[model samples]
Target: MAALILFSVTVSVISEKGEPAADLLRENVEALADNEYGHNIYCLGYGSLDCPLNDRKVKVITGEY
Candidate 1:
């Protein structure tokens, strides 16, 4: 018999340049669309977040408001 185990995690980051980290991250995922879980990061600047989350999705909270 054989089995496979897979897991995923979310990380928080901040970028002070033209491109936000989340956007870049999404783009990077695009490269691996074939095997990507299609994670989404919603950056809500200082607001109550009620994002739909699952094992493959995470809410990105920010304090820029």
Candidate 2:
């Protein structure tokens, strides 16, 4: 008998530069993570670490798919 084991994780990063930057960062991270882990570790979401609710600041970034 033979079996295969696979591992996967969802990553979320905090960014201060808004959704655009967060999207870029997430893309980069996903690539690096896939290489590091030898699997597709996708970044599922992103959010601002320090942005306040009413500050007209960056909001949480979510994956479209």
Candidate 3:
């Protein structure tokens, strides 16, 4: 689930950038994905490893990008 969302975002974001920046974004998104599973790491926010649970569901909260 999460991986699916990220894959789409990665493609769209990188596609817009030049090779160098795109490469960097690819690496960052790859690091976020641990495996084939949809699982994702919780990015530390403002010195804490937490964000509102609602924030995690980007798709449901916001319309298609």
Candidate 4:
């Protein structure tokens, strides 16, 4: 299924950021695949949203720490 492939790709990207095992990756991929909304958020987080994949929008929060 398309969603399965997308979720796998998303999990790979996240795993590449750190040292993740095959089992962990599989678990994450399965979990994400089941949640369509989560998949969208995952795509957005990794800049995979839409076809062109635009940069994330910046939000300005007043006041400095």
Best lDDT among the predictions, by candidate number: 4
* Model 2 alpha-carbon miss at residue 44, Å: 38
Better of 2 and 3 by lDDT: 3
Q: In candidate 2, what are the lDDT values of residues 1-65, reduced to their tens digit?
A: 01111111222122332423446545765565553332332332344542222333344522322
Alpha-carbon RMSD, candidate 1: 16.7
Q: Which candidate is the best by TM-score?
A: 4
Candidates in order have lDDT scores of 0.38, 0.35, 0.50, 0.52
- Candidate 2 worst ten-residue window by lDDT: 1-10
- The positional error of residue 26 in candidate 3, measured at the CA in angstroms, is 0.5
lDDT of 3: 0.50
lDDT of candidate 4 over 1-65, digit per residue (tens): 77678766877787789956467667776776664332233222333234222355333312222
Tens-place lDDT digits, model 3, residues 10-40 = 6877667853345666676677764423334
Model 4, global lDDT? 0.52
Q: What are the runs in model 2 whose C-alpha is more than 4 Å off?
A: 1-21, 36-65
Q: Which model is ahead, 1 or 4, in terms of lDDT? A: 4
State every prediction's TM-score relative to the real structure.
0.22, 0.23, 0.28, 0.30
Specify the poorest-scoring 10-residue window by lDDT in model 4: 38-47
lDDT (Cα, tens digit) per residue for candidate 1, span 4-65: 11111222323333434566555555554543233543454333454333333324643322
Q: lDDT order of candidates, best first?
A: 4, 3, 1, 2
Which segments of candidate 3 are over 4 A away from where they belong?
A: 1-7, 13-21, 35-65
Which pairs clash in model 3? none
